[model samples]
Target: MASWRISGSRALLTAGVALTAVFTATLPAQAAHAPGGVDDWGTVVDTKDCVQADAWLVRVKGLGKIIDTKLFQSHYPTTPQAPKQHAGGRELINLAPMGIGLGKVSALYSRAMGHAHPATTSGKGDVPARGEVYADAGGAAVDIGLPYIQNPAGGTQLSPFGVHVEGITVSAYSQPGKPVAFTGGAARGYISVAGTRIIDIPPIWAVNLGVRIPEDYTQAPLALATTNEQVTTDVKGNPTKGPNGAYKYDPKATSGYVNGIHASVLGTDVADVTVVHAAVLRDPKITDKFAVAPRAASDRAGVPARPLSKSCAPFAPPRTAAAGMKDTSSCW
Candidate 1:
């Protein structure tokens, strides 16, 4: 099971924003697209002849500005088999007193772990590029020290001595000419104080972020997902209008991502952390040039693809109960 364990030395890092504990798990050999036996840990991966996953420890910011530098980071392209990744360090200076770091620990520690993978299975008679693609990251974790702390109001908060975040995952799956499906969450983890468990953190799904809604339908803290059906926009961030009085949408584009933790103190944002993140895009103009059947029929018919689901898969951690993790059974 995924439990937050406080130890002598642990570290946390991230791409941007707040700082918080995160957890990670090893990647399994079988792809997430496989029917079963796929361990969900960090964010899964996706593809468009190109896909990538990233994991990192701490990144500190204050007053909307970056203070600490980006720490150990792991980035890699998608592959046939899932790959495990880990990164961490010790003796880091927590500049919280100076209004830049997450906590006031003199010797802050950090670490991150996760798995990422992208697998594609093609169908015969590839006229219009018929195939299924799956990308996911699982078993993510990150930790940091908070021996002593002061809130934004200048009071001793008696913060935890250590913090550990675990069980973060994200994934995306799709077929040619179909809308991309995204699924992931933070599950089965907690924070600690003085080497003892304190509170249980609830699972968070990317869909609830509300960053992109009624437009993209799903949102994660630092993630983005999209498809060709998205509306085209002008440079001013306004939707473009076509000659037929209808909104113009880009004929090609797609993406996916996973959720991580963002740590804050007394209402002030400190750091942005992610156990794993994956992204994928598709361009129909380029992809359809070699299609066995012309894609114009669907375009002429104006047949929009199926609507995306409001929920996603948990991509559960290693050996942990997947009881709460939801799956898009309709897609399967």
Candidate 2:
């Protein structure tokens, strides 16, 4: 329903010329994967019943007009940067990570209804507010600091077979009122019984034991309260009131540091787990337009959409690696 096309012959010509310039400027790497040598999985498993939740806070400040003006003139000489500096201009002030877990029901809704449901439910239908906020604030603070640099060390993991580990790990500097995007790797482990049925069902039967190593990230928002003494000065500038007021600040907002831990269970075929379809729940009144699509159990039969990789050679360890010794290792 939505298109990303820019119109007009002039605009098209300009875009085509710019694209050609960019492609010609850069050389393609030899590796089949991206620069980091990580394979990308295009799709996730259809585990229709799971829950996930997270919370974060960030702080961002503008670098003042001088920086803004320079950035504006350099990037968009024809138009004001404030209105059209669409890409690459921002700073991350403070980014602290905390933890937020979605309830079991909520996870189930997401798995069944797809990301769009929870995306809309969370009041972020398409545009990720967290990332956009940083982009905007960081763009404004370019003069004070360098443009926001994506943590190359953090990002999604794409497996060889098109199994995409969305938001595996990410890093963000702290800023006020800005939220960092959550990207962490996830995995599920299970044991299956070898047996054959007389009829249509396959010979192999799979049973989900649980998530072997749960998804984890240390980048959620944490709230902290501190007291600062504000001495009211008389005309002579003498100290006035004692430090008594407590100011509440999300640590992630100021530090741009986040540490989070996440866990969840895959659904069992025999268990008949009850789940809320986010799309349906978000718009229950729309009879003509079904928000949530029904997901039959068969959709998850056989091998999971995202089978674990045989090796973890391509991926770097999680961002919060300690002593270079991780308990478990797998791409997805």
Candidate 3:
């Protein structure tokens, strides 16, 4: 079982902690539902599941390292950050977002698994990689970036609940590669109806979604690629290639940024929908979490997403960007 542990304690806050809402038994059973052909056994949902995959922002502190270390120590194809190195057949260079200055990559995986602590064991019975190996972050207290839950392959446990929604929405909040107690990262969203329980979490340690081996690490954050159309971006965050090239991206060898799987949720009635809120980080002392909780289905009638999150002010997207840029800009 490949795993890592935060032996060094630093009172980190747990993000998206479930404050305790009424269980599935509470929600109204009114609306007509559709799984959109999604299959369910407990663990795996079939192909056509409908979810409102929301785009999340990976915010980080101490990002000025890029401006400082012109070398920008980068090592993706897995390593979040590493010193610039080059050789003949054994050369490598990490790209931007270099140093885990943000935090540990495990934070992202832990979030998707719906917990704050990194697991010592893999999801299935997968073998463990050496535990001592660690990722390099520029000393951030935390970081995060993307989704999932695994149920048994055959079972009708989900049938007991009559309040089933179309499908589940998967989300992951993550950090860089190493956990710095002060920095933070998060990605949170609701799954209308997925997973056996409310947590609706999935394992990122061992279960393979699409990442390549060696690079597809056990503690690294991951997402199930929703589409096959790969879009490769470059050091400047520009489109440089297509169909994700080999993983374990070699900076001095090839384009730096390893193609990443960007994701979002899809479905109807997401306004006040029931979602699993599990942020891997968020120090209890630091109540001011930079990220927002996943929105509930808007059609939930009078139900409020937060107990008293102030009256709903109109959500306004910033209009300051170029004319057409507003559409793609984040709502935050």
Q: Name the candidate that leads on lDDT.
A: 1
Task: Indicate the residue-level lDDT of 185 in model 3.
Answer: 18
Report, for every candidate in turn, its global Cα lDDT versus the true structure.
0.31, 0.15, 0.18
**TM-score of model 2 relative to the true fold?**
0.15
Give me the runs in candidate 1 sitting further than 4 Å from their true place. 1-135, 145-163, 173-175, 191-199, 203-206, 209-253, 263-270, 288-332
| TM-score, cand. 1 | 0.37
Task: Name the better of 1 and 3 by TM-score.
Answer: 1
Clashes in candidate 3: how many?
62
Point out the worst 10-residue segment of candidate 3 by lDDT: 131-140
lDDT per residue (tens digit) for residues 120-212 in model 3? 222311111111011111111111211111235732122111011111112222212222111111122111223332222122211112221
TM-score-best of 2 and 3? 3
Off by over 4 Å in 3: 1-232, 242-262, 269-332
Root mean square deviation (Cα) for candidate 2: 26.2
State the lDDT of candidate 1 residue by residue for 1-332, as single tens digits: 12222221111211211122222122323223312322112223343332223333333323234333333223333233222232222232343423333432111112121111121112211111123333333334444434234445643343443344454444444335544455544544444444444444456442323211112225322222111111222212233346996544433333332234434332233332333333233333333332324435432222123213222232222112212212211111
TM-scores of the candidates in the order shown: 0.37, 0.15, 0.19
lDDT of 2 at 100: 15
Worst 10 residues of 2 by lDDT: 12-21
> Candidate 2: what lDDT?
0.15
